[model samples]
Target chain A: MIASTSIHIERTTTPKAKPPQDKLGFGIYFTDHMFIMNYTADEGWHQSRIVPYQPITLDPAAKVFHYGQTVFEGLKAYKTADGRVQVFRPDANMRRMNLSNDRMSMPEIPTDLVLDAIKGLTHIDQDWIPDGEGNSLYIRPFIIATEALLGVQPSQAYTFMIIMSPVGAYYPEGINPVKIFVESHYVRAMIGGVGEAKTAGNYAAGLKAQDAAKEQGYTQVLWLDGAEHKYIEEVGSMNVFFKIDGTVYTPSLNGSILDGITRNSVIQLLRHWQVPVVERQLSIEEIYEAGKNGKLEEAFGTGTAAVISPVGELNWLGVKLVINGGATGGLSEKLYNNLTGIQYGKLEDEFNWMVEVK
Target chain B: MIASTSIHIERTTTPKAKPPQDKLGFGIYFTDHMFIMNYTADEGWHQSRIVPYQPITLDPAAKVFHYGQTVFEGLKAYKTADGRVQVFRPDANMRRMNLSNDRMSMPEIPTDLVLDAIKGLTHIDQDWIPDGEGNSLYIRPFIIATEALLGVQPSQAYTFMIIMSPVGAYYPEGINPVKIFVESHYVRAMIGGVGEAKTAGNYAAGLKAQDAAKEQGYTQVLWLDGAEHKYIEEVGSMNVFFKIDGTVYTPSLNGSILDGITRNSVIQLLRHWQVPVVERQLSIEEIYEAGKNGKLEEAFGTGTAAVISPVGELNWLGVKLVINGGATGGLSEKLYNNLTGIQYGKLEDEFNWMVEVK
Candidate 1:
């Protein structure tokens, strides 16, 4: 087995030209190299290497293809004003990845090794970090069951890999609020399922509802609890927060919502600033009622992709609730500016969330 | 794009040596040839072909690897005493596959095309049908989102393939009863989730509980409803049936339980035999009460892998309930014999469920 300190590197002979800074959309273009590690029942994780970005081959009956035995984490490497590279709370993402591994019945990668691979790969492909505004190199670390078997069990073999892609801002037209559809027919996850894990199946379960919402001219779908479809769960791919009657509220970690690193950071910042943030179950009906009484002040979603996605309008059962007159709220804009400023090394790192790449 | 009637074949240059019939276990040995088809947004499903069974190359960023956009079906092709190859209720499995595709936000294939591929592949690999007791050629038809993207949306490209494996009986000791663990912690799925669909995530979520059950000396874990955790859902990967007093009871299709073909067939056969049967919500507490009152007569699971797995003992919350004195019930044995008889062409298939492969 390859140890954490003995990672091998194979540089690519030919490197492709990077795409234009403005053209770097989300997850479209990739860097020249990637980090990989293999795992077998007998040998554990071995052959840790950094090689050119390439295709992977597996037997037709590999478990990941048929059983969805996979998990992944997404973060970004930011280019600071001082020409230095840094990643935001990579350790937290790695720790959460381990939690996901535990929930998905997969072997957890050592934290040190995961950090080494991420830092090493980001340093090597540092040039891929776009210089344009709101552009950074998105890092995706994932693990998949590679055992060539056709059974419903934990795989005997696995592969862990990290890939990099330069991504532009989630919204090209500044931090504008997006229209959301309240989904009632489809559910993303339940309490006892793999909803809390960063596994593939949770994302797949949301696609149908997302597609339907898009057809209805909504930017995203606001999911509700799986059992009663009453309490709010999440919005799109992020943790949501609602401001009503001068207090901020986000859904508590009820074992169905993802414990997002950004969500945690947002909560910490809100508490530090004495913004009266509370984590509890907030139902959609209550939000609508607040909207009717003119108490629904602000709503936004927090995640690595968008950082802070403001909510413009919510349509539930044909009853539209326009918050802040379909405009971004003051708290949403403030959170976005503060979070992005800290990520880009402009704001003070009061919580020490930033980690320099090299 | 290739149509249903336009499937091409490429014979292998060198065929593989078939494994010994006695040594053939489930999903371990593969046939020489397999069927494959591809799908893209612009071309729909195309390039339908039967080629040598081999490894598939995919980009690391394929949607299946990251987002679990995959679905699969399991059925068996039997070689009867008359030397004819046949498959049971294949159309039902194909229809179920399409339902899974719809739930996962993927385009469904034509039923005619899927039937053609299964029949064509079975005809070509007839020699691989093992000549052992309860042995058959297991067919695995799967679809995966092959689009090389890293976002949580429906993939624009997909690959559908059918592979075969030779297998023996599910239980080496014959149709003997097995112990089951009543799970209370982890739920496989809930209402409004992808529980009814034969998608990858549903199977992935059950592995952890399955592992724990195995460690506790149980053959399978009896999953309960995700919301209330009271109503019985399924047993391992199969639909469960219980006999209390005199009537046969199986959980209804409540959107959380899979619509098992075997379960449906058993229900039909029972009704034809003038045996009372009911489909409704069966709770664990009620089952325990029946066990205490000696009214619980029989219990078994139904699925493609194990036609009927008799439940000998159930360990729930540290209370062990031994059913039928740790032996297979008369009804369980009868169902197994009748089902296997119909499958092997020994008894009359009154429902005309068997499809003869030509």
Candidate 2:
């Protein structure tokens, strides 16, 4: 692994002014500089550099273009009060990135090297981090197979890159409830697939269903297990949780669900609050039954993008099951506030999850 | 749809010397020219042109690099004895490409536009078509989301390109038999997924299992059904077929197996020769039983790369089931000869599957 001191930097000569904070929607605007490292069989990962954010040139036959041999991670850099910048749970994202590499038949990336790259790039673009409420610098680290070959094998060349985007809150209208379509058709993934990994293919396979749900006025599709099509797997790209009868339930890690960092944090926070939380298989039928009997109290999704998104209603095969009367639940709001507060450095982080950038 | 007459051509000033026919491997050497087109939400598909083969420049945040929003199709251009260039079933590939576009939420290429692009590009680089036995120019057409966005949604801009590569025979040792490992651990795809579409993710998901099988001294892996793991799905990237008691059997298209164009042609040829062919779910146990009872006459895989790859042995859970004593079967030879003969213009074109490039 290359030391952090050896990272070569070439500052951009033409730096443009940052976009207006109010108009900084998701990933439209990129920072001035980006981090890149190349990997090859002859010379492992080498030539770590930070250069001007620019277009990448590749042979049309690269494996990443034809075979989808790619993986990515998303996290954010928060500008706290008093001009401090911090990143939340970056180690977890790096660990999960290695897991994705293994499942995609790619080489493992050293955790230290990844952390160093993130830190170096984030520090260089520290001024890009937004200080507004719910706004942060979204960082995307992705790896793509660059081997110019057209075969069904693992690539011999790879490129790991990190780019930053200044963004606004996920819910610009405040933390409101979102309507979800319980998808009975079109499975995202099955056992022994790359569903558990943050690979490109799993997301590509979900575009059709997600678009269909959007056409029907739903925010996201609630995915079911590919094998049985009965057990709940995830809500869109986020891990889901249900609060019923004063107990919290989330799907267990069944080899098909992603190990979400935010989901883990929520579980830990719930346990600390003495809330009854269980990780087990919770089927859609059971959730519907609970809703019919007035026992289902709340439902929410957990992910880095949206810390906690409350589910107001679920349309399962044309049957709408309203949760918490199409309003955000009390627990959901509390969890969201606490998580955001800790992230923005407004509240005490008892779990030591935040890592401040120097 | 624009007519074929509107495709503008730009010739390369420095033409590349063609590689030796004997050394041309699959997807390694490309022709001098290629076809490209662009698509956007406002203008749809526009700027159809044949330009010199070169690297494509894309923004670092292109959707294809992160979310794998891409689809591809493969076909071949053959050089006939009469000095005419013909493509085998180009229409089928275009239809399948549209199906893939639908599944991946990309805009469809009109069949006429696709055909025109293929014909125009093939005519421009007709000299690249190798003349050796079993040698042909492999054609690859793919579409990638080019919008510079870092979200999971489908892109608003796309690029469709067609590149040609001269390839030798799939098996340099001729049409010999191969040993396959029955994979029950890693699933290539599942029901209601992108298995039926020729998308990149399905191929990426099979690399780990394919590499593992290769490490165990196997040529390829035979994928089983994702749910029960009882029924056979496919062999490597090809559609599999089995012959028992003089009847040919292939797995039915159960939403998990790709609709291979070569597989369709073989079925048609079998029925034309009065050979009884059945499309049903064939379990691995049933095949093992047939092999043990000396009733398994032949097994083969059909795809564009390898027209007919005979499977001589199947190592299922360490139990070797050898068919025809590890030698190519009579039926396998006949089918291969007939298919190749028709492809190369050596035999009568009874089915009229070839389209000449004028």
Candidate 3:
């Protein structure tokens, strides 16, 4: 239960020879070392190791193979202007990860162990953190059921690993506005389903819809609620934000959308800056009417990878909308700047969101 | 596009010295060789191989890792009394597999390659097949998105594999009737979702509900429709059936429930035997009332893995009633025996269902 007692460091021999800032692809490249810990029904999670980047050998009958009993979290390590490495609100990600684990009937990862895993891997591979603007080490911390069994109970064995991939700007071509295809046919998660959790299944459900949207020449699939399919739920991989008047509104945690860490951070930042913020069920009809009536100013998505991707247009029910107030709004830009400012140590740390690593 | 070209076979060095028999756990023991084929946007499915049974090294950022862009089908190989190996209606499984692939936005496995891969692996691992009644080599053919990317689209690269695990009887206790937990909270799939597909995401979503049912002492979770959660969709891993009076009825494949291979067989078998069978929305309330009124006489599940499992009792909303008539019904017994008989070559293969291996 307490991971403080065991921690062993195995430094990477190759060490990426050249730093990762030079060759950063989304997730194609990896860091020198990664954090590893195994959990068994008998011993729990033990033998924490900072193993070099290598392929994991798993049995073909691993429960995760047949039954997708896996959950994951996405966050990043930012190299500040002062050459200090920091992670953004990792506790929040850990909390969400544990919540996802609960929903998937997986073992609860202690927040400290989660933090320890992060610190262990990120520290060893800290050099992979890219500097300059819009560059960082993309951290993927996931827990998977590793038990080799046929029966379908919660897996008795589990594996938690943190793998990092050096990533460049999500919108490498500046924060250009993008079009989102509103998927009326497919639903990501339901009222009693695992949508709120950052589990693998939620994303898997959206692949087909996303592909169809791409064929229609759209960036992401904006999923709707499963029950009614009237209310907006989430976009592919991100929680969305809508602006009306001078106020900001985003969909609330309604059991079917990922409780995004970035979504909450923006909400808090808006309130901290004295801007109006609302969390409620936002419907497509309201949005369509809002855009038509000049009330809807801007719409954007928020996630760890993409800080804020402005919506240039929203395509729904064969109707195309020119999202008013341009792709990048003043408020969205300001919020992004402030958020990244805290992340890259460019602004005063008012919320204390970044965790500095030695 | 064409798989008329034969694949290279990499023989296993460590074949099982003595294959397990009598008590082989489901999906626990595997054969020496497995069939594999790689796919790319340019070449399609190529480099097919019957490789040694080993762990596949997938990048942590593989699309299947982040998004559950994966689908699978399960059938079996039976060693008849003449010691000839044959697959039970593989073409049916292939058709369903392709349908599942289409729903998941994955490219369909060419029928030629699908047939070739199954034969390639099963032939090499023929010795692993168990003997006698109710024992067979469980064939699991699965396709996963192997593209090393983070974004949510149908993967550009893929890997298809067919792994065989020797299995003996789902329930070693002579097919005793088991109770099912009528799951009201957790939903498996929705009409406009990937429920019909044998995708990993659907199974992942069902794990939590299944775990809860296991905790409550139920064998499987009887999943309901996502809209109202009243209609019976399917049991944990099989299609459900019910006999109301002399009429046999099961929930029609209204887009959500899987078009199971075994389910289709049962419908055809009973039809051939002149038993009235209908497919429509069978609501939980309707069936419970029918059971109370003695109209509902039988309930069972049909799937490739579990040929048929009789539902002894259903715990629905605190109303637990033993299935009508007895522990096992006459029709269920007859159907099970007939199916198993045909599989083991005890019954005449009138329908041309079994495909003999070359």
- Which regions of candidate 2 are displaced past 4 Å? A1-5, B1-5
In order, what are the TM-scores of chain A for the candidates?
Answer: 0.98, 0.98, 0.97
Ranking by DockQ: 2, 1, 3
- Candidate 1 C-alpha lDDT tens digits along B1-358: 3234478999999999999877887788899999999998888888899999999999999999899999999999999998999999999999999999988988888778889999999999999998767999999999999998887889999999999999998877789898999999898998888999999999989999999999999999999998788999999999999999998999999998899999999999999989999999999999999999999999999999989999999999999999989899999999999999999999998999999999
Worst lDDT run of 10 residues, candidate 3 chain A, spans A16-25
Clashing pairs in 1: none
- lDDT per residue for candidate 3 within A196-256, as digits (tens), equals 8787777777877887888889989888888888888888889999898888888889888
Q: Candidate 2, residue A277: CA error in Å? A: 1.5
For model 1, the superposed segments whose C-alpha errors exceed 4 Å read A1-5, B1-5
User: What TM-score, computed on C-alpha atoms, does each candidate reach?
Assistant: 0.98, 0.98, 0.96
What DockQ does each listed candidate score?
0.83, 0.87, 0.64
Please, what are the lDDT tens digits per residue for candidate 1 over residues A57-169?
99999999888889999999999999989999999999999899999999878788888899999999999998867989999999999998887889999999999999998
Tens-digit lDDT track for model 3 on B1-358? 4334577899977777645577687877788988888888888888888889888877766777677778888899999999989999999889988898788778878887788789878898888988856889999888878887776667888888888888988767677788899998888888888888888777778888887888899988899988899899999889999998899999999888999888999999999999999999889999989988978899999987778889999999878978954488888889898888888888998888998887
**Candidate 2 — what's its lDDT?**
0.92
